[model samples]
Target chain A: MQTTRTTPSRLAKRAHYDEATIHPILDEALFCTVSFAVDGQPMAIPTAFARKGNKLYIHGSVGSHFIRTIENGAPVCISVMLADGLVLAKSAFHHSVNYRSVVIFANAEKVTDEAECMEALALITDHLIPGRWDDLRPTTASEMRKTTVLVFSLAEASAKLRAGGPSDDPDDENRPTWAGVIPLQTVRQTPVPAPYNNDTPLPDYLINPQNT
Target chain B: MQTTRTTPSRLAKRAHYDEATIHPILDEALFCTVSFAVDGQPMAIPTAFARKGNKLYIHGSVGSHFIRTIENGAPVCISVMLADGLVLAKSAFHHSVNYRSVVIFANAEKVTDEAECMEALALITDHLIPGRWDDLRPTTASEMRKTTVLVFSLAEASAKLRAGGPSDDPDDENRPTWAGVIPLQTVRQTPVPAPYNNDTPLPDYLINPQNT
Candidate 1:
């Protein structure tokens, strides 16, 4: 697959592009804001996605409008953003945020082959929680029939990111207002047992903080 | 102002019509994903926003492409979502999220009057951080001239929300996979002093967790 990089604009400075910076941000994200046109109107849909190598996979019910739109070979813009902190600045105009985000602009195509569809579904499952495919119950035929998986090659993608403390005006430093970064984070808490469980030990993947 | 509510779809399960849910979510959010069409191409741009009593305000440079498109009176969809957790389920097909979000569909109008322009800026600042307007230096004339603010009356908005734990299939309850929510939150850490600071105490609002 060909790899294309898009430069970060002034507004997109809060977005990052390096592989090291992009992968972690994409991996940590659970949902993406997808924008596409439907009947001459712009529509933004929040959907779950998985990134495998250079391809991004998004799945939904076959009847879903978003899937249908992409099935027709429409270009879609998918964006995933993790808001790390609220940058409280000295000035209103200068106030900003510390966030890491990745945007993929691609022409999505529907995965039609049964084998490829199952693989994409497994990839999505593994992306959400590693080792989930082997551990969880397998999908039934009906489940697969109902699902529509769209795969977009991330060849024309760019990751833009901003981190660290606030960028305040030099002259406003002495102002009494607080000017700094409030670092935000997403942490996985202790898992609650399934109501019908027989008190099985939690998996190492779920209990281990490092795995998260 | 006129008050109207848009019906919620399955994609908008967490939206509420009551003020209790709508007002708080709108007030706490700092930015929104503005989706609009430019040259028949759909784009979603993240920008800072402020909410007044019944209207939401967003401002950017007059030369910004986003502003230029919205100023032409195109229909826009502005959305803010707070993902509360990852709803880990027993099956990959059933996995979803618990989130609180508000999506507003309205025709945007550019704010032109000087008095309304100043009010919108101040409202945005105060929404970002309560009591911040009095603490920081005011916007200069040059700053005002460079910025273009747009106001969208929140009257035509709807809030969709989803809360609580995972919704796993009953048959898969006995599966060994751990099933529950990994709660996500946006927390503010202690502010870091600006490089040029003279070691002044952080403002009371900055230290207040509620301000976030």
Candidate 2:
């Protein structure tokens, strides 16, 4: 859905509107920046998020300012970016980054229903760690009361991305400079167990998430 | 510089108002998300940025909607977040992330002076890969015209960070679930040479950036 607000005015070729291109980028990243205006001034805060079907969920302590400010159905922009690599070109002006980014525009609404809130909370937990939610103790009513859950539809969203080697001008290609991409990868390191652990073996999901 | 807007109302212990706490986080990250309102609707874009002294710089083609909209000295919110790890707790409500984040509210101004623009461009290039800027072909006047650079002051900025393992409740600490930190690290992969490379040796700056 390329609404008037979702389209990019420049470099239009890089913009994408279909869910095939947008949904994976949303699911892959662990967090996103939520942008909105309070009294005509803009503010952006980074928080963990999860995608459940066509809706995105984010939660925080009810007392947090970001949660309180945007829970009233304010227009918000949510952005997620995965930096792939640094694109080095023969010319200084051509230096760019290889990245996949999605920006979504929507009005956020609070989730007041208990079942939906619980499902959203579980979805968020499973989104971060595939099977960890059920393994942990069930959420108590007190914990549910202390948190605020906000939801936004992925109906009006767009993704823009750049990949591969540098696109240098023919004239600059022969220059005596090294040009290419230095790839960046985010890897999960060895997990550090908590001091009070009762020696529970590290879960296989944490070790082999791709299989999950 | 803890203005009403920059201050967080909850979990106040994590907030820091001084440059000693903010500047390093800004420098270590390669980019930030710029947030602003257009026609009363909020928009957020992720772009590469560099910090020089008390100012942060970002640029794009002059034809881009983001550049055209913000070049008029609009009020903007810039946010940088470095996700450290996933903090898994015994209770679902206690699960959180270890991260260092900084948010700044400032008015953006277009760089009109040629000297300052060139300096900012070079600073951004070097900021991404130290010593690579000087090796590339110099920027042409035409190239400068095609670019739009925006700057924001570091004043009115604050940083909030959380590190270490999960903080679970005393009652849940004895639960039979594994709790810990799954550290996330971004590492550079092998560089891929462009198709037209003249067999130029990969520079030390690219291979050993920490030494640079």
Candidate 3:
């Protein structure tokens, strides 16, 4: 489903509200900064999230104040970013980043149904590693109760991305100063076995997580 | 110097209030999510930042709401995260990420003085591409007045990190399930020349930013 365009919460010039643009960023990024407020004070917390359809599921301990504030219907802004590179222009005024970012505004409601909660938990797990959820021991009823799951719909969201190159001042283009991008990348590192893993070989999924 | 610990905004178990631990994460991260409120509604925007001593300098156009709200001394939460890897544990309940993150709280004040603004802009530029600022054209007077730089002190902040491996319940350790981390890494990609570049060679800083 295409996300209907809405007025950006901030920079209207950079906002792009559409599912095609939003989903890929959400999928590529492993961490999202969740913003919420209490008593008029705004705060941002970085956490991992998973998206299915239009809903995003984030988990926390049932007792966490951050989780409670979100599940209690407090307005929240969830942002996921894919920072591509730094845009170093001829002038500092024009310096910017080449990034694809989505900021979702929603009132997250708690996932109270046991079955749905379990499904959300599974999505969160598999989102991090495609099939690891099935490889592990089944989650217990007590564990489910101990966890707090909240779902926020992507029904209303906006994405802003800047690409290409520096928008330098025309006059400075002729100057000897070099102007271009210093590209950034995020890739997987070799996995380390926990000291306790007494010779358990690495799994196929992990050794080749990208399915390469 | 060790970062003096400060109070956490939430989830006391994970909060660390020390500049020593905080600065490294901030220095390592390429972007930070800055949260601010308008009419009591919270918003988060991912932007590049530069830290010098105990202050963070973020640049934006003067007319942007995100900048205006922050410069007005409205409460803001600046969050920087270095997501290391995913910790796939025995059970979903213990699933987590190995990350180093810092959340700073402060009322940002505009850097109005022209010299400071120039220095801040240089810090921001060199922070992204070390030494490039000095190589580029010097800041012009018009640019200084048009840009807005906000300084947020790191006096009240918290850092939280979870490294090592997944902290799973000991009972599940014996299960034959494959459990470990699939480490995540962020690296620089080969630079993409802007379409408009007329064969300007990549600068030394762009080719090897760290100067090593």
**Global local distance difference test of model 3:** 0.78
How far does residue B93 in candidate 1 sit from its true spot (Å)? 2.1
Show model 1 residue runs off by greater than 4 Å.
Answer: A1-21, A168-170, A208-212, B1-19, B208-212
List RMSD in Å for every model shown: 3.3, 1.8, 2.9
Better of 1 and 2 by TM-score: 2
Using TM-score, give the best candidate's number. Answer: 2
Clashes per candidate (backbone, < 3 Å): 13, 0, 6
- lDDT by residue for model 1 (A134-183), tens: 77788889999999988887776677667666677678777766677666
lDDT tens per residue, model 3, A41-133:
788888878999888999988877689777878888888888888776766667778898888888888988988888888888887787778
lDDT of 3 by residue, B167-208 (tens): 778898876666678777777766776655667787776775
fnat, candidate 1?
0.51
Using all chains and alpha carbons, the TM-scores for the candidates as numbered come to: 0.88, 0.97, 0.92
lDDT of 1: 0.73
Using lDDT as the measure, which candidate wins?
2
Model 3: per-residue Cα lDDT at residue B43? 85
Q: What share of the true interface contacts does each candidate keep?
A: 0.51, 0.93, 0.70
The most accurate candidate by DockQ is 2
